[model samples]
Target: MAPKRRRTVDNESKEAVQNRSSMVTRSRSAKYVKISDNNNSPVVVFAHGAGAPSSSEWMIRWKNLLADSLNAVEVVTFDYPYISQRKPPPKAEKLIEFHSDIVKMTAAKYPHHPLILAGKSMGSRVSCMVAAENGIRASAVVCLGYPLKGSKGAIRDEPLLQLTVPTMFVQGTKDGLCSLESLEVVMKKMKAVSKLHVVENGDHSMKIAKKNLELAGISQEEAEQSAVQAIAMFVSQTIGAM
Candidate 1:
């Protein structure tokens, strides 16, 4: 009887341990994403581009820049499930639902504060889609390198047309996927207030050419810093007007 009781106790203890481990794994995967250490209002929920994860250099840099620059804006970053699972990049259309869910969750978590949906490249497109389709009210949307047209000249202007909220696009002048001309044409049809801040001679990643940097009398780091500063300004002004 004593041996049987000991066996039961051990089993219970092992079960408890397993339960704890499972919880930890779930928590880790849950993306407990809060922007900045302090509680700041008007959180900017940023989504990473198709090519990179939320922890990539570009995402981290922008996250820190927005957090520090805005002072009041907490910049939250998140990863898509496919990226989390280390799977190949899925179609952008397939990703809109997932990204919208995160945005909705973030909005629900902080009900009082306003939200600014911002994303990089493909992520930016996703943000626009969510803002247009889902009824989640974002104060504004910022697209850091909007892919207006695919490399094969396939245009994706529907999302831009559907948005009724104020939007700001920070586009690189030299980006192949989104030529300045193509984006301008699409912007004309958008009813919402929109602004385009051009990054002179920058690529899709907003990396300025070395020659262009020399022309601006700034280093590569300075060029990126300048772009971030511009983004910070746009966020501040947009949020302030609202």
Candidate 2:
């Protein structure tokens, strides 16, 4: 009888250990998200472009820049599951639910702070899709190089047209994916109040040529800094007017 009782106790203890380990694994995975330590409002959830991970140099650089430029309480960024899982990138529409979940989590975490959804290229397009969803209610959206056209030059303006929140676009003058003229036409049809910051001589990633930078008499960092400053101003004015 004693041996049977000991065996039962051992089984229970093993089950308990397994349960604890499972919980710890889940908690650790949740805690692994990328978030800044600053505890302040205007929490910005930035997303990465299709070609890079959240830890890529461009994403990391802009994440810090956004934090400083917006004086945000914190900036949250995450890689899309496809990138992490090494799967092919899906259409922007397919990513709405996943991206919205991240925004929902971040919004819940900082319930009292102003929420801003910003992203790079394809991420920016998805950000617009997520922002246009019914309950997300972001205070504003800042699109960094929004991909407004397909590779074949089909216009993708439906998401932009649906936004109810104030929006700001940081577009490069030379971005082929979103020609300023086409963007202007779409902007005319948009219901949301919108603003644009044009980066002179910049391409899709807002990368200005060295010669152009020299001609403009500003370093690459300086050009980006100017864009960041424009973002800061737009965020400030938009939020203040709200």
Candidate 3:
């Protein structure tokens, strides 16, 4: 007799089976805030950076800003277990599995909606890893304050290199973690279509100097708003292409 194939459901996607019953309940300290102007809009799930909880001022500001700025898209933000537990974050590789679980839960819950994974700094790297490993294609990815290198100046381009989906990277001009010159080199080597937006004089957190903002004839708010808008525009174009 011929060997028989194992049963497969939902078009035989392992991602479907692996996460089918693995829906993650939002932790006690976690929240699922959604912003949607249109029901048909793509779902944008944002993971918090390594150092900050989802409720941190930076995350809160961007959560509200991206939701408001992205307008039509639905944006959801959540905290990592370490952040919720008040402990030091695990190494980057260790967080990918957990991050993937959260993302898979979100995607499964919103099965029909186009999904977009986004993150800040270390979170961005995790997003890319999940997309690459899970076999689930995201419409696009938006990397806010991507940490291209560690504090020790070691390049972290492997995750960026493995991404198969379009990725837009919003980096601060002065961010030591992501040296523009080095990032450009990695981008050139990437097979994925990559776009970069430089936040003039901004740092790791994308904070601009009041002096520089004054010289540029734009308010700090305007500089910040531009960063959000750039990501919004990237989503718009990417969604349009899809």
TM-score of each: 0.78, 0.83, 0.81
Candidate No. with top TM-score? 2
State the C-alpha lDDT per candidate. 0.70, 0.77, 0.72
Q: Please provide, for model 2 over 1-242, each residue's C-alpha lDDT reduced to its tens digit, 9 standing for 90 to 100.
A: 01000000111133432343331111101111123334424899999999898999999999998887787888999989999789989988899999999999999989888899999999999999999898897988999999998978799999998888888888888899998778766776788877666677889999989887666665677667767766776677777776
Error of 3 at 44 (Å): 1.3
Tens-digit lDDT string for candidate 1 (1-242):
01000000011133433343331111101111222334435677899998899999889988876666555445788889998688988878899888888888888888877788889999999898898875789988989899888757899998888998778787777798898667766766687667666666779988877766665555656555555555555565666676
Ranking by lDDT: 2, 3, 1
Model 3: ten consecutive residues of lowest lDDT: 2-11
List clash counts for every candidate, in order. Answer: 0, 1, 0
Looking at model 2, report the run of 10 residues with the lowest lDDT sum. Answer: 1-10
Model 3 residue 43 lDDT score: 78
- TM for candidate 1 is 0.78
lDDT of 1 at 57: 86
How many clashes does the backbone of model 3 have? 0
Q: Tell me the spans in candidate 1 whose CA falls farther than 4 Å from its real position.
A: 1-40
Taking every candidate in turn, the Cα RMSD to the unseen true structure, in Å, is 21.4, 22.0, 15.8
